[model samples]
Target: MSVSELEPGDREFERTPPHDIPAEQGVLGGMLLSQDAIAEVIEVLRTADFYRPAHQIIYDAVLDLYGRGDPADAVTIAGELTKRGEIARVGGAPYLHTLISSVPTAANAGYYARIVRERSVLRKLVETGTRIVQMGYNADGADADEILDRAQAEVFAIAEKRSGEDYVPLSEIMPGALDEIEAIGSRGGQMVGVPTGFADLDALTNGLHPGQMIVVAARPAMGKALGLSTLVPTPEGWTTMGALEVGDEVLDADGRPTRVVAATEVMHGRPCHEVEFSDGEIVVADALHQWRTSVAGVTAVRTTEEIAATLDEVHVIDGPDGRVTKIVDVRPVASVPVRCIQVDNTDHLYLVGRSRVPTHNSTLALDFARAASIRHGLTSAFFSLEMGRNEITMRLLSAEARVALHAMRSGTMQDEDWTRLARRMSEVAEAPLFIDDSPNMSMMEIRAKARRLKQQHDLRLVVIDYLQLMTSGKRVESRQVEVSEFSRSLKLLAKELQVPVIALSQLNRGPEQRTDKKPMVSDLRESGSIEQDADMVILLHREDAYEKESPRAGEADLIVAKHRNGPTATVTVAFQGHYSRFVDMAQ
Candidate 1:
């Protein structure tokens, strides 16, 4: 009967309708079990029941159709489901399609995809015995909040399971993916290698690799810049991009100032004279003669502005100092473009050296100094003896045998002691060593340098001469902030560069307190980042230098205050006053 035809209270109060009897049992009762009945059924079948042959066959068929880019229709799905024996009732095929189709498309698709993607999640949710409210017109009177709470709990359980501990090594997951292919290497034919400038230094470090930020640091007269100057090519072979400005006087490699003279004037006797024409062209005869001479081409125009509209390849003038006489049409030169390689002139070297400055900030300098001090302390204490011997061998007497002979003749040390030191020094000078002297290098520049070096030349060792001298910028207000920034920058740079950045640092007046006089990490000037960032720290202490004509003579103690990678120890090295170098201790 229609709702309008029936009187409001005419029906017997509290009496159940005839159809409600069957509806309360079996399928009707199940339909009333949940608001999202279809989704609940799908989730149940997808996880818990999927392991059953029937459920597996049905899910595989449906996923296969989806993967094959075919539309899933009720009839096809019913056939697939029936083939898998998931339906037993005679009319189950049509009944299942009706049930599936009756579900909201958005809700059904989302639920199905989630169940498929995260099976374990759905399994955990179902195991929780979650309650759900029915969402059909027939079962409109259901507890929505209870249903929502149960569903949320189930999903949360599943999420937890999915995020549980699991580990996978990169090697097993992806094989041969990262293997290097040399044919596709950068810079064409440039082979990656190490720099073998010293022996003991190389022993501790393999060698200087390309693209590393090596810091070579020292106090005012420690030969920091001189050491850097010795690395880059001098005299010729290097090209520069910008203008080279030497101090007021320009000097060649021999320290002689060069005088500029016109090439034509040198080649020819007289200065080149010129005559201008009405058509905006000039003709010239050799006046001040030069090495090269040619009046190639010119352009003619009525207005002055048109004169600039000429090709760069074509020569527009008669000669140097020669006047334009006639407007002549000429084809541009077809010479091949020569790739200009920058020559490392004094100015160019300065610019390259300057580009390594780190940012002007507090955290970086402190970190850089701390790292440098630690590195210096460790290397100096343990490897200084070897470094000294290696330096002498490479730079002076070509062999170990000659070191003892020279030591005897020079009266620097006893023959036996010198021989023993030389042997020990030679053994230690085999590792790689790299030094970067850039003022304040940025992280990007440091990383780029490291990566490029590794990729292009496979270099691993690096060094940076004295840390404090490295400038971040002129804007830094306090020396503490500047040093802190420098320190952090160096640490990050060392880690990124994947090489040891041995930075030299200055000691504060604290060293003056003790008579023994060896600087400590606390003695690092200005910033504590040096202590925080360095893997090692070494202090060069000379007791004789403090006293005038002291009996200790040429002995210097390389003190190891911090060693992040190894044991801390002190070593004695012979300090040569004449050459400003060090030598290993006699055994």
Candidate 2:
């Protein structure tokens, strides 16, 4: 029965679902006639988009040949169908010829494919509505709210399907692929990826490239912290602790203005202490907040907690202001919201409050997301499973602006630090860097979000803070197997999006037993699988971290343990722990 002729009260199941037989035939015929038509139609219409079973078989056969770098013409398609023993089901070679004869021109292939897709969408909607109605009728004791939610999900599934990738002809892909290859060749083997800004690392690896999975594994423990209400001196005037942000300026230990490179959000309800100076001036800070002091004519940086514990001894403030105020008291106080900031000063010291209380900030380690995005201008997505969004932003700010991470975190930024930050603020702010810090995320969820981000922002790189933290969300035999599965999926994701995926990993402490304390590829928690799945493996090692007085105290070795396309070597780069960044030694 015709769909238009059916009445509302009549059984709608008797009528045919929405479809355009002529449009389907036209799409197939055009594709069989021209490679250009195949390229156009392949993107729009999948095998199931055809109304007739025979046309679906023919379409599949055409794609099969085209994907194998063979012609998709009538003869080749018929041969493909015969190989599958489906020639008779598709009405043999004669029906294929009929389809070609039916099409006037292959130029209209896209139009025909669109019509086929529209009909297919309509058919899917009908099927979905039918299922939802059945669910409603059979929902014995089910909540109406639950049914409604399911109905919405059912409707949304159609939208998801519409945006899905389908089987495509290589003919449509080869041109761009070849262009990229030629472009790389034209550079005379120069770096093609987002540069790490480290000359030696970039030289060995040719930069971080697309469709590659780079595993960065290391041993743990590296960070620094600070309090909110302390006053900071900026160029404009003194501002409260919580008021400072990235790119602001404040006075440094040398009494010079330096830019603030990084500033974190106010962390609330943190343990704080009050330090009362002999001069009647006072400053409140977190237990971890450091202060510059002298005891017995010896200068050192001590945390508020450390100083408080030793309040019995005489302590004097020896600051850049040249003030020598003896500490009358250091006592624990109420917990309050606190913020921190980092500066670009070598001393990493800044003044706070009307009395110009001297404060100190500690340094931290780094990452490459900001370098890729802000420095290289490549849009990137960072999935930080371990750290929150604020922490990620703080790291990026510190790295890009060359500010001390501890100063940024401790609300102790200098004015020069602020000036330097202001110079790079625009670049950091405008760079297409996205961060997701959803904790304990499953691989499926990460992949889904990455795909959406890529679709929206054209993501060029993806970074997962550490792979061991990710869950597969599936039942598996062992932890190793689960990790292996995640690594395999990560590799597939890289190839699917055609972008680099850097999955941070943790070493199994095997490096600690070694004399050099250097991490090897075998040190990766799930070494066998990760080393197999990754296109490259980079081990980060700092000798000073293991042996405090090592000769290479400020240098880090980026050991390229496994390079699928090149030679393996150790690239020594300056580890600016204070700035939370790595740089070429020349800097």
Candidate 3:
């Protein structure tokens, strides 16, 4: 019978249950057409959410197909249903074929699923109402209030019983896991995890490990500390120790209004200050130092030089368990001899240095030596510690045209050289290259400046000419520890900026003493930790430096002595001293 033809008395028996058959069909059709649609509708509706019993069977079959990581097209779904002897019950192959063809686009599967869910909720409401009415009829001597409460709870339970989520078969789950493994492989696996800005921490705990709690705990305590006081945020306002009177109303952490039955101030002198809540929870006021010291001009109060000593110098306060900072003091000392590397003279800041060969580096035309890093289609920043930006640009022009560096230096360029340089000028001018000749550059300065460059130019690579030339600008107990910290910081900067930092290292006297005169990972100057922190380490070795009579005098060996993810090997590239650059053999 039609639903509209039903009278009030005959409605229960004559009227159809609340449902939209087309919506159920659309949701099923959407899932069958698009493999991605299954995830959208899986949590929103269930087998029972369908109005037609046959459609429920089809939905279950589609879920089974998806769970097994199999396609949910008509053929595969029908095959699974037929294997279970349920295809006949679900209207056979023709019905399965008709399902996917019903939808032109599966993108609206979520909308269709919600419509089906709404209909299901209405049907559940009607079923609940029918049961409540029957309960009223049978309410002979039962408490009317009890019956009403039970009926209300049962109706609410239907709403609470949403379709289950967070369930997936192993077949569907394994593919994403494999994809992540491949991604980790791409990131060299050693640095696959998030960085903690500390190499020691990264080595010990893998840097704020995922799917784990990061608890800061101290080891071997030197002294004890009083407990801390905390500020509890509540609905009426922030909860206070004195405000927890018997009649006072305050909110809980969940923002629910809670009446104060009892609150006690405890451990007043026991090295800890805390207010014990009725809920047995404690709030911490450890942030008071951060709010007061680091932040400036928050409360519209004028702070004197004594209060706002931030201009003096920045301090990096460190602790075993945790740390807080205080930026106070402002004073400048005498200037020292500072040097910058040579590259483009753009106003951007850079961390530049010079890599001088042991004895023969001088008079070898050192200009444009840093520009070789830009060959691989990289937007490079060269921090020149010694060379001027003008000299570097001239060398780059010479190198691009394959002309003699001396010719360009002496303004003795020929007509052909000028023609070649004009063509290369357009290439050089538009390239994402930057040079900074700032002398006495510090690690802090490099980090701040590099972030600005990356934001402005989307910088891809940073070349620090040599690691030994860098200084933290702070005195330490030993130089080794300081260099190691700088190395770790450089590694951290690489990860933060999401770019490869190609830092040249000036090997110690060890390489010169050896008969082979080849640099190794141990030759990285002054810091053993550089080897530990670097994902890849390449050492420059020239046989001709020791033996000029060698057959490959111009050939340089780039020894990949350390590779964290793969085997190390050597690559041969020709270094033309005339052009002051390395040229790939293929080029």
Candidate 4:
């Protein structure tokens, strides 16, 4: 029945999220006549982010015509709708013209679009919140951790659906900061991080203060070790680093075979390996303090020549060792990978990274979502666009239990394996995580589901299996546009929920054409908006996939290619494909 046709409260039992019909009409009406207004309206809302079906259809027409670089007025829009046979569907041509006459000006089109978006968000929140309340009520009968995660996820989902945060005045913020300081003082503490446990550390920093992040990082070896087992290739033959002792032969960076005359002590806290090449330059390799951070925690850096590359190669003859090479070791450059995780005052959005098939990107996504729920005690929701629910469960079980994926799949688990799996089963059963392996799902469905989940669970994080697979609300002319719209919607979803959305992405073979074969931001398959809309992009590069002759045979690179809020760098990780898991590359 038409809502307007009914008397007030005729269907009092019928309930829905809030909406304004005239507002929707006014927005469409404003854009239907003005070509200039279409640009402004499109920025604020997508056709599906709207509440009503007819409004969505009308907005889609406006966007489609605008995209084609055609003029969009009421008459042209009606003609286009008629051509597509949607004229009667959206109340026909009369309704189209009726919208134009309804709006006083096209200038408020953006404002009207915002109103539609706001209503849509509000409605989703109401729907999601009710579901969360029901979940809470069922908590006594349900698994608490799972229910809590779902409930938290649902609430957070609603929070994320809203955009922007109100700025609190310093007066409002400083009192809390000062209160923290006062509490520390009352506890006989001098300052926040002002004095560390160690006296030496306290002297160095005076005190670890507030509003700063301290990272205690594990080191990754680079430079001095890329030539591991040093059967390093030369024109003569493959020679080991140890075999080529003092006065032994080895190849230089330029492929020159030269004798190593002298190995000298260089310096600490610097790339200090100084190996002399007879009648040539000395190779000074500063091998100290080499480390790189990755998405999967920490792992070894790629090359021993990292810091040594900064040095100038020079030939310097000294003593009776004849003409020899000397390496001028240079200090290395440092990178700031991620920022401090501020409890309440900060926010982060991330693109977990990219991968080729079988690189275990999905496994990494699972680990990331699990970490949010388990380690940080935050609720997480995962949307698996590819794998089914049971398969994902097995993988999760394998990862959580540290059991081989093959064992879990084959049901040939040993005694300890079963014990471990049993112990973890309870933990896994209780973890506040929600997973959905719905196939061919649309973005609108994801939003509604996520909002519902958030309302019930207070979900702090959301993960979409992959971007390209997400169904768009409407058929787009170009595949790029379709994916672009999805990417934009995902961004809005993250912002609306006020949580990180780790959406896995598949990379193009562009990485395969290069020697390094590292996925770049450009390698993101179809849409340019994938990069544009994302706050951060982490690219996964597995060297073993690229080369049979690499020490990185067991490793993958977590390349932070685009970080809108922080630094970008590459770190290493170990992908245990059989377990469907990833871990910090162990030393």
| lDDT assessment of candidate 3 | 0.55
lDDT of 4 by residue, 357-447 (tens): 2235666677766656655556778887656678778878888788966566445679999998898887787888898877568777787
TM-score of each: 0.32, 0.58, 0.43, 0.44
Task: Indicate whether candidate 3 or candidate 4 has the larger TM-score.
Answer: 4
lDDT of 2 by residue, 1-587 (tens): 77677887675677689999899888988998899999988878777778899987887778768777998888988888888999999888998899999999999999999999999989989988888989989999876654765576456446545532355569757866998899989999788887766777778888888799998876543112334655555555557777777787876643347888887777767788666643324566678877777677677998888888887876776432232345666667678886667888764556555322211101111256766787777878887655557766776788778886556755778999999889888888998888787756777667777777777777888888767667755557977898898899899889867788988876765786677777888888754899999999988777755443357766778889999989999987776655656677765
Q: How accurate is candidate 4 locally (lDDT)?
A: 0.58
Score residue 367 of candidate 3 by CA lDDT.
21
Clash total of candidate 4: 47
Candidate 2 wrong stretches, greater than 4 Å: 1-19, 28-107, 117-203, 206-211, 222-366, 376-378, 470-499, 526-528
Per-residue alpha-carbon lDDT of model 1 for 113-201, expressed as tens digits? 34444544444444443232232233465444434433543443354333222465574334333333343265363323242222333
Give me candidate 1's TM-score against the actual structure: 0.32
Order the candidates by lDDT, highest first — what do you get? 2, 4, 3, 1
CA lDDT of each prediction against the hidden true structure:
0.38, 0.72, 0.55, 0.58
Better of 1 and 4 by lDDT: 4
Candidate 2 deviation (Cα RMSD): 12.9
In lDDT terms, which candidate is top? Answer: 2
Which ten contiguous residues of candidate 1 have the minimum total lDDT?
A: 219-228
Query: Over the stretch 347-385, how does candidate 3's per-residue lDDT look in tens digits?
Result: 111111122111122211222223323333445577655
Ranked by TM-score from best down, the candidates are: 2, 4, 3, 1
